[model samples]
Target chain A: MVGKHCILELYDCDHAKLNDEAFLRTTITTAAKRAGATLLNLITHRFEPQGVTGLALLAESHLSIHTWPENGYAAVDVFTCGDQTMPEQACELLRQELGAKNHALKSFQRETPAALATAVRHPKA
Target chain B: MVGKHCILELYDCDHAKLNDEAFLRTTITTAAKRAGATLLNLITHRFEPQGVTGLALLAESHLSIHTWPENGYAAVDVFTCGDQTMPEQACELLRQELGAKNHALKSFQRETPAALATAVRHPKA
Candidate 1:
């Protein structure tokens, strides 16, 4: 499939208290819905005395987040199979909701499956 | 952190019988273990009458997989934080375990956090 994927590495987030499992689940679900995406299923893990990690499967693609409360850092990856803009919007919502600062974000345009298969088979021969 | 990420889109696989929830959990767990990565926690979802999706949190990074039994296709994303080589090895193990064919794979090198932050701040200013 042809699509855009965004991988965001959020750093120096101010909301350490907001990085709990319950908060992440709510934030991710709301962000996905606001982006006009459907949520298939979600799983969240609470690493005791550390931080929370969450993954949400969307009908569009997927979103994964990992938090480091002690370091005031968080890593977020949002990938979509079709349109590219929604992932950026979702990241903005997340940054605003979590009060992140000194943020870092990266965008990637994924290659089509056919192109990848061709490269693999040929291998510069 | 600078690292490599491998996103694999496997197609035309013939493992319909192996796509159950239990089998996926075992296979993914085993693959991660053999890669010398630390397992944090895992969450899997079973789409009844369809297929399975799983996400494993690894100290090295993360692995997410989605299967479409009817279409004989699967999508896997493996990402690492520090070292780049482990993700590829993990993907190979997954492909072998799932008996995938006609596979397509894409590799990405994530930008450093500082670089991303600069780009965001400048934005052609």
Candidate 2:
């Protein structure tokens, strides 16, 4: 199956929120639900001095975020297979909750070789 | 600090290897070490009948893989923040271990807003 992957670069996020492990875990878990994905498990880590990293494992795929509190930056990835899930929605939720002043988002498709062949043969289909 | 993120799509792989949870865990751990990343924790889940999903949490960032044994396809993501780490090397190791006959790889840098501003102003520095 083909999947949609979104890479989000959140800038000028709230430093406190970026370093708050509990908040991040809640936000990521909520983001997964917002994307219409099935949450299998959620894991998070808090760095020694600062920063936080989290991953939300979903039945469709996975969502992850690595925050750099000192820089007011956070990098997020949301990937999901199946047409039912909207990975973009998850990215948007994270951006909003993190209070990013500015952000850059890149979205792409992950297709298997068979899917690529099908797209080539049936460009309109 | 700026980070490198690599997205790999492996196709035409061995179905048995794709579904082997033990092998995947070992391979991903080894890939992280090869990239000069510090491993924190590893978590994996095997789906009913077939397929597997694994994540290697690293001090630099994280590496993850999701396999589809039925279609002989797998998707991998390796992201690392330190300049000393090589995300590409981890991706290559995974590609080899998974035995993907044909694969597609995309790599990019994830820079924070501060870094972006510095890059734009310095231009050559």
- Please report the candidate that would top TM-score against the real structure: 2
In Å, residue A90's CA in model 2 sits off its true spot by 0.7
lDDT of 2 by residue, A1-125 (tens): 45889999999999999989999988988899899998888888888677778887788879999887877889899998877799999999999999999999999988655552222110111
* Tens digit per residue, CA lDDT, model 1, B18-68: 457788888888877766666676777666456567888776567888666
TM-score of each: 0.74, 0.90
Clashing pairs in 2: none
Report backbone clashes per prediction. 0, 0
Interface RMSD of 1: 13.3
Top DockQ hit? 2
RMSD of each: 9.3, 7.1
Give the total clashing residue pairs for model 2. Answer: 0
